[model samples]
Target: MTEHAPTTYLLAGGGTAGHVNPLLAVADALRAREPEASVLVLGTKEGLEARLVPERGYELLIVDKVPFPRRPNAAAARFPLVWRRAVAQVRRHIRDRDVDVVVGFGGYASAPAYVAARREGIPYVVHEANARPGLANVLGARRAARVGVTFAGTPLRGGEVVGMPLRREIVELDRAALRDEAATTFGLDASRPVLLVFGGSLGARRLNDTLAESWPAIVGAGWQILHAAGERNELVDSAHPDYRIVPYLDRMDLAFALADAVVARSGAATVSELTALGIPAVYVPYAVGNGEQALNAASAVAAGAARLIPDAEFTPDRVRGEVVPLLADPETLGALRAAAEASAPAARAGTAAVVAQIDEALGRSAR
Candidate 1:
């Protein structure tokens, strides 16, 4: 029998969960498809990938964090030398590891990885997780062998809507099957519908404050609350039996399983997961960045799969008037859930679609 050389894949991205999580999802898919294939991660020492990539058991390749200079300054003066060094580092990794292709999820490391892969004549793929593309993705898209976007209207060169690659737990979760256990895990009544609220890992002060002032109204409306306040949050948990508050959600699958509806930030992953799971939600777009959060939730809102409230407008009064009434109305919630399910087909295919892109890129390389 003849022996075949194992293919090597270099996935580059990391800074936040938005980038790292998707990169990990594709990596997992690649490994599952070809156990003997080499799966490597390129990331900066300062980014979240420093911890997470290693924790996920993938080999982490280090790259210098070089921010694109917005203005002519000292860092800008030194940008060329630094950028050249970063690209050279990635090129060397590609050559030494015999990398067949590169897949980037768009972050600091991706910018240079894209350049390196291009210089080395190896195919590279780009995955943009936001409705508004980032600088790295914007540049990479111009030459990427294939470009994937999480939302339909994201303007990127050759971009196709492939949805967001999600965590295995989120992808495989069966909310109805897990509801009773999830209810027990959160100490809530399985017989009652639960409202889940969160603001990502750090928690959102806006959500915490609004809930603090308006939770009584929610509880009074016959809904249970499971709020994952950020770890830095100091909002004291009220001792109300129906209202449960935690610093962070280590078990998001359980939280999703218990949630009949959600009130949370519209991060790409959050929006993707909620819609993918068919959970109706009210999105409070974080009032920072390039207003991408609002854009992220737009499709869902348009489809009646979710509702949007600006961060500045997510006040206690708004929650009392709008959110409370929505919770009290089961018919509307059911419709929202159905809309979410209807909008989920594309999202559910994200992992497979990204992996297929990778496979096609590899096939082209072989040819």
Candidate 2:
């Protein structure tokens, strides 16, 4: 009997947390499943991966970021040469490292990784974190061995809804058990209903401004708030006893434990985490991109797990008129919670699904 050699993986993606986080989740999964496997991360030096990948104990491979030109200009004319350099860099790494699979999560790093993998006759996989796929993933999906998407409606050639691969902390979090500790950690009473407000890392100006204006009313209505005002937030603390405002939160699981409801931007990770945990949310999709944020939250909303407020209409008046009333109604909140629980997929297997696809491809290649 002969033992098979361990698989070698080259995971590519990184720029924002959306890409880096999912990449890390898959990396972590791969490592856990096959402890002896060699897992490498390919990313640009300037990306968050440079810091995060090494911290997470994976080898970080550097590649130059080549952004595709949308408009015809000098940069557009120079794109082909720059893009070629990136592909060549990736191809060299693939050859030298003897990578068995190239998994991409879509970033400036992924396009070249995809092209390189194809040229090298290596199996490749793609994971798109948005309902609307990005340019890199769109190009890569055509030839990928497997393509997984965070949302059901993502328009990719071979896309399957795999949910989002969540952090281990979130996947294992028992919110009910941690409520008292979480409430204490955030300096709020566990007995009261908590409304969690956040707008990503840098914070949402509109969300912060509206919540700041409406906090007095929110607190007056007997709800506590745990608001992460972002690192560069301009919203001043109103000094309410029940309201806790911080620039950022390192422990999101704690916040989720105490939160009865959430007000946040509907980024892929945020929506996935909230629904996975069965936490009801009022989504304020960022007013940018191809409206992907809104699309990300669509299923949650349609399933009655969440509500959506257009960016332009997310004002103090709307908060007072709409959000306040919803917060005040326990029955409505209960309904939302139930819906959230129903809407949330069995997310524990998201990474496994991706890994399964890779394994399937490997088996086929071997045959």
Best by lDDT: 1
10 residues in a row with least lDDT, candidate 2: 358-367
lDDT of 2 by residue, 324-363 (tens): 9999998998999999988665655577677777777676
Please, what is the whole-model Cα lDDT of each candidate in the order they appear?
A: 0.94, 0.90
Question: Candidate 1: how many backbone clashes?
Answer: 0
Per-candidate TM-score against the hidden true structure: 0.97, 0.96
Question: Which regions in candidate 1 have their CA more than 4 angstroms from the true location?
Answer: 1-5, 364-367
Among the numbered candidates, top TM-score falls to 1
Name the lDDT value of residue 73 in candidate 1. 95
Candidate 2 lDDT at 132 equals 92
- On residues 279-351, what C-alpha lDDT tens digit does candidate 1 reach at each position? 9999999998899999999999999999999999999999999999998888998899999999777788898
